[model samples]
Structures are given as structure tokens and as C-alpha cells.
Target chain A: MPLKSVYKLYQDMETEQSIISYKGVVSADLLTSVLNIMEDKLAIIEESVSIRKKVYNVLVECLQNLYHHNEGKGTFTKNAKQSISSDKASILIISKPADFYEIKTGNFIENQKVEKLKSKINHINNLDKEGLRDLYVSILNDGEYSNKGTAGLGLIDIARKSNKKIEYEFKPINDQYSFYCLNVKIN
Target chain B: MENINLEGTAKTPSVSFEYDNGTIELRGRSIPENSVEFYRPLNEWLKEYSTCPQPKTIFEVKLEYFNTSSSKCLLDLFKLLESIPKDKTSVYIHWYFEKDDGDIEEAGEDYQAIVPLPFKMIEVDEI
Candidate 1:
């Protein structure tokens, strides 16, 4: 493929109405900086306290997932190389409209993990509030904490609060990796 | 312990507790950056309150939304309420849900089923 064509594809993939977008290595420091900037922007919008809290939580969960799960460096485990660019990094975008705030994060994942993720989303989407609560409790009791102390409840919490279907897409990046995009909207 | 009063943040809920009256109110959204740090003191206050036990204790939960972590903390609070002596302390839990928010209403009911305290599910007009 020509260099120009590849560049065009990259740009096209990034097309979005991003109030805040970060493309590079994901780290706690970088995430904090982005959150600080976003908080200032959100403050100016004068959203209600509840809405503001929801937005902040959603952003934190998205960014932390990217930082912890991004399969970069020598850790080429599973479907790492295909979706995420070991050299290029991941992307996060926060957009706002009159009615809602949308947060989107894109990172690379293994092809094998896609099916499981899709199934999980489907299961969550099918649940009512009580079902979601039961699932959360069951998961809490069953699942071990991640290295970062995450209980794997982030997605469930997102689903519970959002009360909306999570939007996602997977684009083939290579043989082992594929770009994964997850979007959550808070109104 | 000193009274716990924190203004609500975008991700954190507003909290006001009076040690004297044993009256506490939690309102707004609760998805705190550090759930443990945010809830620890409140839990402590409840524990202390259980010992002295005010005659009338009312906990007004008017939260619009909360995440799973916050839900766990809430369950802890309700359990504390269950432990208090009924005669010495009369606990009234007023759970407020938005009129149109069926999810919140249902959640309130679920809590009522588990908690032994007198729980009332009240609907509030939408903002």
C-alpha cells in the first residue's frame, strides 16, 4: 500500500467531533492531564452536578481500561499486534452536544477477545436494573481483582448508569490485532 | 467523630451527617474517583451512631444515580441500619426516585426488600 493511502486511512478512522482527543501512549499522568482539561471544559458548560459526576466516571473508566489492557511492548500476548500499533498508540475522544456527552475510546485487542466482549455487551444490554444488580453482585463475588485492583465491574457499572446500549466497532489492524472502539453516552 | 460534610462533585455525591441528631442525607450522583476514601468516614459515622443510638434517625437517599461501587457502600449503610435497636432507634429510610425513572424506583424497592428498616419509596418530579 502507498504511504499516502495508509495516512488517509488513519485520518479517516479518526474522523470525529472530538472536544478532547489524545493519541499516543496511555499512562496515568496523561490520563490525569486529559481529565483535568476536560473537567475545566465541562465546568464551563455548567452541567448539573449529577450529570457532571456521570461524565467524569465514564471518562475515568474508559481511559483506565485502555491504559491497563493495551497490549504493547514485549507483551505481545494474544491478539496484540493486529489491532493496536505497538509504535503508534491508542485514541480517546470526548464530545458534547446539547442533550448529552459522548465518550469514545479506541485501542487494539486480540481477535479472539472480540467474541467474548460482544457476548458480554449483549448480556448486559438484555438485563433489567435488577438483573444488572444481580450480575454485578455475582461478578463481584466470583471475579478476582486485576493487578490494578479493578474488579471488572467497570463495564457493568457503565451499562447500569448509561441505561443505553454501548456502541462499538472492530477494524482489522493486522493478523493478530484489531482496533476496538467503545462509545458510551451520558445525558 | 467530626461531622462529615462534603459538597457534591460531578462524580462524588453530596454528604451531610449530624452526629447529634443522627440525621444523614446523601444526595446527587455517586461515582467517586476513590470510592473507598469517599465512603470510609461515612461508614465510621454510622458505626458510631449505632452505639449511642439517637431516638429518631432518618437517612434520606435522594441519589439520581450511582455506580456499582457506590451500591455496595449503600448496602453497607443499610446493614448498619438493620443492626440498630428498633426501640432505642427508629430508622426511616426515604428513598427518592425520579417520577419517570423506573430503574431508580425498582432499585429502591430491591433495597427495601433486603433492609429491615422502615423504607419508603417516594417519587420526585423530574428536573
Candidate 2:
């Protein structure tokens, strides 16, 4: 962490035309603040009410997914005697690079959970608008809630609203954990 | 049965279920961190209301936006409303959406498809 890097970070955000960027622990209170801020920002940037509503709806799903999945704190053994701590903090960035708004989120997840999540997103990505709507309704009727009260419909809802394939990646962090990043574009 | 009137917040909706009149209302946003906890009491209240409901029950949902989790809870509420015997009580649901909000309109349609309750979609200038 150097003094000059702070300026560089600011420059990068400006270059991306970022509306808002946040990192660290994601909690319910923080989610409220983020939503309020985004509502105000989108109100100014987007003139059409429908597009604003769509972007706001998609943003809610994305932030909630990040909050539910963030690990917060974890430790990994580096060697026989040394250990490294991983802050499993989550990240959210809303930027407008072109005509569309780009929402990017990142969080830590269990390594074993990577394949299942990847496959789910892939399945959602492969569906057309009508197929996605059917899947969403079926899941809404039959899907069981997880311990965290999520019904596994977040990604599907995001796909349906954005009308675009979800872009994601899972970067292995250690034997037990991986960093998951999701990027969604709303036009 | 006792009535329910909860104030709306930034994350949760305002609810008013009058047991005597059978007028149920849910308005505003519903994206609580724990949607289950927030909607559990309402679900229970609906279950109780079903046992001896009024002649005609009117349930109005005028939500600006709701997350996926809240959507599931809302469906649960609708199912309970659907369970009430039609011979005993007839339930009417009015799903409200703001102008140009297709997502909310579509959501109402989705619920109408699953639950056999009489649903009316109403569009307005604002919510």
C-alpha cells in the first residue's frame, strides 16, 4: 500500500466511468446503503423508467448473492509451521464503459462448491428468454430453500432480466477455497 | 383473530391484514436480509385467517420491487390463500405495478399461473 497507488486507483475508476465501487464484508445494512446509493445514481444516469427498474432489480439479486456467499474470514495453512489468513471479503463495482451498465461482483467460496455453481450458471446461460422464464417459474414453484433462505433463483432471475449470458470465473485460491467473480451487463 | 399492521421500511413492506374485514394489503419493497423471518408471521396469520375467513377476502399486493427470496415467501402466502375453501370464502387478489415496470407485471402473471386465486393486474403511474 503506497501513497501513489491511491491516485492510480482513483484514475482507474475514472477511466472506467465507475458509478460506485465497494469492497469488504457485505452485510444487510451495507446492502441497504448500496441500494439507496444506486437508486439515486441510476435515476440520474438512466432516463427510461423501464431500464432503471431492470438495472435496479438485477442489482438487488447480485448484491444479495454476494452477501449470502461471502465467507468473511478464513485461514489456510501455508506450510507445516506457518499459516496465512484470507479475508474472504466481497467486492461490488458498477461501471458504465459504453452503452450498457456493467455490474461486477466477487466473493470467496468453498472449492468444492465451484463446479456446482459453475454448472448452474452455465445452464442458465444456455437458455433462451422463454426457456429462462419457464425455468424461473418452475423453480419458483418447486425449489426448496437453502439454510440461508435462498431459493437458487438469483442467477436465473438475473439472466432473465438482463437478457444476456452471465459471465463468471472461479480462481483457485487454495486447496479449500476459490475466489468467484461474476460480471453482468445491463443495457 | 387479531389484526396485523406492520410499518414499511426501506427493505421490508407495509402489511395490513384486517381479520374482521378480510382486507389484506402488502405495499412497498420486500428485499429483507432474512425474508423468511420477515414473512413468517404474515404466513402464519394467513393460515389462521383461512380457517374462518370473511365472506370475500381481498388481498392487494402493491410492491415496487422484491428480491428472489421474498418472491418465494410471497408464493407461500398465495398458496395459503388458495387453500381456503371456495365454498366458505372467495379471495380476490389485486397485483399492482407501476407504469413501464414489466418485471413486476410478469411476476404477478407468474404467481397467477401457480396459484388458483383470482388475480387482477393493475397498472398505475407510480407506486
**Candidate with the greatest TM-score versus the true structure:** 2
- lDDT of model 2 at position A173: 71
Per-residue lDDT for A128-184 in model 2, tens only?
988998999999999999999998899999999999999999988777788899999
> Each candidate: RMSD to true structure?
5.8, 2.0
Query: Can you write out model 2's per-residue Cα lDDT over B19-80, one digit (the tens) per residue?
Result: 98999999999988789999999999999999899999999999999999999999999989
Pairs that clash in candidate 2? none
Each model's total of backbone clashes: 6, 0
lDDT of 1 by residue, B1-127 (tens): 5678889976678999987877899998775535656788889989988988889999999987665556667877888888988887999999998766655676686677667778888888852
Q: After superposing candidate 2 on the true structure, give the runs of residues whose Cα lies further than 4 Å from its correct spot.
A: A77-85
Question: Candidate 1 on A63-160: residue-level lDDT in tens?
Answer: 77787677644334445345323643788878774478888888878788888988888898888977887887667545655554456788887877
Candidate 2, RMSD to the unseen true structure? 2.0
lDDT, each prediction? 0.75, 0.91
